[model samples]
Target chain A: MPSPARSALAHIAFSDLVVLLRGIFERHGTSAEVAAVLATNCASAQRDGAHSHGVFRMPGYVSTLASGWVDGRAVPVVEDVASGYVRVDARNGFAQPALAAARGLLLEKARSAGIAVLAIHNSHHFAALWPDVEPFAEEGLIALSVVNSMTCVVPHGARRPLFGTNPIAFAAPCAASAPIVFDMATSAMAHGDVQIAARAGETLPPGMGVDSQGLATQDPNAILNGGALLPFGGHKGSALSMMVELLAAALTGGNFSFEFDWDQHPGAKTPWTGQLIIVIDPRKSGGESFARRAQTLVAHMHEVGLSRMPGERRYREREHSALHGVAIAEQELAQLRAMTGD
Target chain B: MPSPARSALAHIAFSDLVVLLRGIFERHGTSAEVAAVLATNCASAQRDGAHSHGVFRMPGYVSTLASGWVDGRAVPVVEDVASGYVRVDARNGFAQPALAAARGLLLEKARSAGIAVLAIHNSHHFAALWPDVEPFAEEGLIALSVVNSMTCVVPHGARRPLFGTNPIAFAAPCAASAPIVFDMATSAMAHGDVQIAARAGETLPPGMGVDSQGLATQDPNAILNGGALLPFGGHKGSALSMMVELLAAALTGGNFSFEFDWDQHPGAKTPWTGQLIIVIDPRKSGGESFARRAQTLVAHMHEVGLSRMPGERRYREREHSALHGVAIAEQELAQLRAMTGD
Candidate 1:
């Protein structure tokens, strides 16, 4: 089964794509500020080839906004809680705007105190997590973030879904290369990827999920309908998911993955949870340049026969997009155009 | 093959075991302060039924000390790097004493700033990581720690071994339960567990490691001899191992797992690397007690049919040991007594 040729795809400049996405978001009920932040995030994901969180999510966003489940125009309230802590109440809005509102204070604290933490609650986080942390690495800092999604993953040794496909994202500066970055879903598979698979009528690998009866199944539809995904690496990943729930939800004073019920608001797709981000200034470390040391690690990784670093593929995709416009299937591009009412 | 009956094992009071182990450490040339910390740490592991890192590690500690690879009496030098960061130069000594020396200041900073980080360099870490973090949770703080060990793991997609069996341990408070705690190696299994299995002449599960020729094998001895372990969950765990190296070693001005060579000193068993610990004061959270939220999460997990939490078994073992005594094989107890010259 050969894929469509590159010539069959539509290509658009990154800026143009962002504009289009922004228009769609603004038209759908989000404030201009939120539309700007979300547009850039989704555009970046698309440019970097993270299609699971790219424009494919636009429909979900539109539907969620229409459902009145989320306050698309809500302004975030940021508090300087402590010398090293910043708290944000997203006012039932998206997490990105909350993070954007607190970014300056978080950066200030990290610079002055050597470390800082941002806790965003009452937020809907539906996009990729890496975008929240990678920028800090670009600023010569280390960042780690976690966000709990809607419950669809079963904890290890548990019979039902209690935990979300909670994801952990990390980024660190490197001297001679792009920042080291990785975003991993603690679940065996991301829910978005599962949806994609179901859409394409593809089967997943074994150990990924089980059916409603708790029998192992590889059918993406079954897993999406009533079954649940498993955590990666068994109990270790499950523990990490539990940690995410504590840090992102409990510590942030937000609803847990299973706490929010959107039954009345049909078409709601975003998880109304919380997020936590920790940033550290590597300049305050006792070591040689943190970035230089990271470069050394990269060199050693290559020497050991590693062909790519964790975020290398994304970087490559980004560069390709920069050189020759962002690639998208023609049909998907048409859908985006329809969404924009342009 | 059935395991030995509990009645066949010897039991000693926790304090008595600590005294015995302390004597062995001091007799092997450690300072009394170092001996006290190491003994309590080891004894706690034994009391918790974590035999892999319990009295079983005493021989390694003594041998490393005898080889003059690590200092036994060097005083740690702590630097108040920032309002939220503390750095410790361990002077080539054991990490526990360094941590003990700075724990108070770290706690104070975390309390003041809502979060703090402690970075210890030039330290030898050879014990279970859980003990390093569980105490922080006991005090109602959340703690996360990572330490990179000697290289024994092949990074995913790499041809050869480059990363250590880096481990991440986390602890958080729960309202009505013992603090939630878990320590896990990024590798398929902890190196200590592999050594214990090899000594017991037991085979490991598949995918644990490769033989000297890089062929998959279940023989634990092969992994201990010239082979290497694989990262758990493939690339995701490998990325975490890399993150541990960056955080624990690179960020602390300490040697990476593969950077230190102990060939000049025979009997060196500990990794001369660094350790990173991040502690957060959950009291600063905007939530209705963080511990209470964690308890709710635990309740939900149980409702989902979770049989036990991550560290429940360890807590149970500790309770049993408190009621009875710390169980140890008679042969091992005799060896410990012999090492103490008692």
Candidate 2:
């Protein structure tokens, strides 16, 4: 039904996409190496069909850098406190390089001690979290990471917004196939969706948000005006948000969703978030049979349906896109090219 | 208009309940020390108003012993293999004593290493998980635990049951007040609720379960007849279940939900389940200001709502029951008294 060469259905070369992103970041004062890492990650997301976090978000990052809200040239500093604990101060910069630098040391510690924790503070993480966790899983390790964001979502039941759409990402290594990874926001709906619904004058699904009086409402306009987003699955999702606040913000001595100051974070910048990541070597915990056993479990899920595993669809998208290149909408491509001043 | 003492409002002294439970466990071959730990945990659950996991589940444990499903007299053996890793071979026994023995050592490891992982296998975990995590939080440590159970919940989009309701518990300690704890199952509805609904001829919520043909249905009768329960929040909850299975069961060399052998378990017995508990010293991660910071977060939540915190109501119940006593239904009390052959 659609031609690959058509403007509406064009597939951009993954390398070209990464290069364009890298050039933009480099122009904004990020080191070439760091820009490459960040750009590669963004490109990979687009390749894997996570367009929301991929090329679509570049304009946000550009505006953040233009407003001088984040220090684009800043490099992270690492601190190894204890045997299994490591801390990285992103120094009010991007989270990509800091997370990258911490990963190798974390893997070494987990291999020897069976588990290791990495706490990244003063970081602005705009990218999807799975890229950060999937690397560990690919290296035969289990990884979990959660990060706090600017206050955009509400807790289970409260009057005001005090929590973030704090997302959690987890990955497990498989012996016979690709690693299984899933990343999800704790909010019932992302703010962008609520905004679009409001602009379209469409009623939202119940439980997506609340009104100014903290009463549940299906009106997106009310949610946009003064209300807040609800947590997914009611109370369970709220508890998870609390856990994320503690683990990512409090534990790292970073900004909680409610505590982030507008003075320190100007414009529409990524908040100075904190991420806590745990990497574990399954060989020590699960014994030598861990990988084989994981494969069996993965196969069982696949036996039933097209999508049972958490990130199966993502992986499938990745496989096809790797060979065919990433799909880019014509309008989106024009916007991306406009950013490059082409 | 509630009476202090009525047939439906019978109260039992917490001490008396613990003593009775201790006697029953001892009669079934558990050592006094292990019985004391188990009984204290069970009694606390009742006092905290978690009736489902409290005295209500004692018959399940008793039946486990009668069926030789667990070795009541078994003492857990802890093997400290790595710096930050500890494995407890529960030796096919109750999880209470095994967890009790592992707690102190875990604290020491976490204090020194900043984080520690405890993988427990061949254990029957039937009680509330918060008791285990709360102790760590009380000691100024952060704790997270997840456990897998017999297959009862289906993965998202699957017709057959493939995962457990698999509960996850997390706790954070505060400086000025009680610790905050939250534990939840990943199912939209517990299997027990479905069975009760079916027997009572009540319909269920739309997304709670599926019928024999795997179509979403509200009919409880259809669910009971070769149907399965759904995960909470659809795929997100299912991902949590998958995470639990990997962290708790697969990582511990125990059974995945589908792999749980019913042939080895009979009657109202608890099956051999695995639990994975992680303990981290916030002092190492967050520095000395951790507790105060945590208290501020907790206070902020309480400042808005009556009970936004997950275990706030439970804590209130505990304090009331401690001052007075646990209120138990007369019919339920008679059943417990009968179990004790009083």
Candidate 3:
């Protein structure tokens, strides 16, 4: 039986978290390399202070493994590859491996062709995007990625969930600070936040979600029951969401909203959901000056007092966590411990 | 002097309209070739039913020429060229020539590099973006462009105008039909429309603009009295507008909101704004299969009863206009006739 009482909050070293998480993943059948990559991504998220996407997601990922939804031992294979593009069939593999592999392949292609696009299908969810993009930034390339999901959002005025949160992430190399990364969901709010609110039995901020009858509701429970999520910017956000859905689902030949079995497999449905990745080496265009000009642009923006750069705050958070251990809520750690039976 | 306002509507042949506009532009020192390109863009907009950007903008373009803000005889020079990126200095030249040169350069680079980005500064406003992007789409490429202007909009909660009514345009190739084109302003209503409302002594739609106190108001005059236009989708739209500003202004090294002098030079100050263009060759990725998959996606969307494909209605309008000459409002026709002294 699971413990009703929670474990106390503890300062777990980043290395310790990785070891613990990897052990659990390996025991669940993931290959050592794949488990390590997944754990590294989780740790990166925690270090970046993105608590929602960090270890908090592990309980669900492990649950997916137990239910056989995420094939821990599966691998991705190339379906087709061109001078500037590639298509990968994940073979129901863990998304971290698929994403990492695709990113590497795309960077290689981009080096030669100046730009490369990778379409990945049939993979499990990879919780955080920055980890996938930061590497490209380190390599001095711009990276953009998008993913579609099981429908949990309504088009602008519609009453039913017809689209996914559909995230778009962009990372560009900067001069002084870390790469400027912009990661966002097309929806006003994400499903994870709604689930968190529901679990806490709390009301959501108004305008983030709606009830089953299409009325705006603060109650997360009502929002979860056949309710629809709102777009970030009304029609414009809806338009971008639809675009992501096309690139990720339609382009890669993955199942979309209605086609997915949402009830049985809720980490955004399709046993083989798709994602698209793009990388561009700016040196291929304007040489080193591309980076110089990009840096100048950021400096000009800072001159106007825009507060923080796109990814600066998160990078700072990661720096802080490196100096002082990450904070894990007692309840969350307890849940993870119970799930992994560690 | 203006011939007592010719009230009767007249149907001018589309060819004649093009020739007449071209002739006027040539008379203002623009080269015949540049005039032809500019005229073609306006004609296409008229054909596509976008009157706001078509001939309605001609008088303004010519006035910029007359005021010596736009260098009709000047040509764009490539300031920086990279493998897949280019930056052009328009030399205060007309946008048609600058844009044509930039677009051609980008497309040429994209053919080999897979993708290309071009940024232009010191250029006059280009009237329509579709003509600039459609040619690339015909070759199975995707394109995106953005333009920034003088301050005309308020940040989400601010009362004073602090940003431009920036515009974004995107186009993607289609297999069986015209390429999908979408162009929109970040503001709920454009400054031109607001000016028209104020001139007609009419009120604006609710939520369109705000008064001096940052309160929403429909009174166009009040909104124009030290007030400002509101963004389309509150904070999200504001952020997008800011993004556009940064891309078009900062990246292109053009004047920004606080730096613009809209009234003083009319042509010199804010007239030489910035623009960015991107072209992507899809064939470099999925080959013929890409187009086929895109068709399937469009079909699925149409099956879902979405209003229409991105550019379907516009293409239809163009077809209708090609068969039968376009409708020209009497007042507008008279204005054109007077401008040309016909």
For each model in turn, which proportion of the native inter-chain contacts is also found?
0.84, 0.64, 0.13
True-contact fraction for model 1?
0.84
lDDT per model vs. reference = 0.93, 0.81, 0.70
For every candidate, the chain B TM-score is: 0.98, 0.90, 0.89
Which residue runs does candidate 1 get wrong by more than 4 Å? A1-7, B1-7
Instruction: Identify the candidate with maximal lDDT.
Output: 1
User: Which is superior by lDDT, 1 or 2?
Assistant: 1
Which pairs of residues have clashing backbones in candidate 3? Answer: A122-A272, A284-B83, A285-B82, A285-B83, A285-B84, A286-B82
lDDT of 2 by residue, A125-238 (tens): 888889999989988899999998877677776667788889999998888888989998888876645654674577887888888888889999998788888889878888
Task: Give the top-scoring candidate (DockQ).
Answer: 1
* 2 or 3, greater by lDDT: 2
Model 3, span A1-342: residue lDDT tens: 011123465666788878878887887778887888888888777767776577767877776776677678887787445556677777787666876666666777778766667777777665766677778877788777888776677776454567788877777777766776767778887676777677666677778888888788999889888887888867667777777776776666665544556466554322346787877666644323445655765565555345566666687877777777765767776666665566
> What DockQ do the predictions score, one after another?
0.87, 0.62, 0.28
Q: Report the error of model 3 at residue B127, Å.
A: 2.3
Predicted chain B of candidate 1, TM-score versus the true chain B: 0.98
Shift of residue A301 alpha carbon in model 1, Å: 0.6
DockQ of 1: 0.87
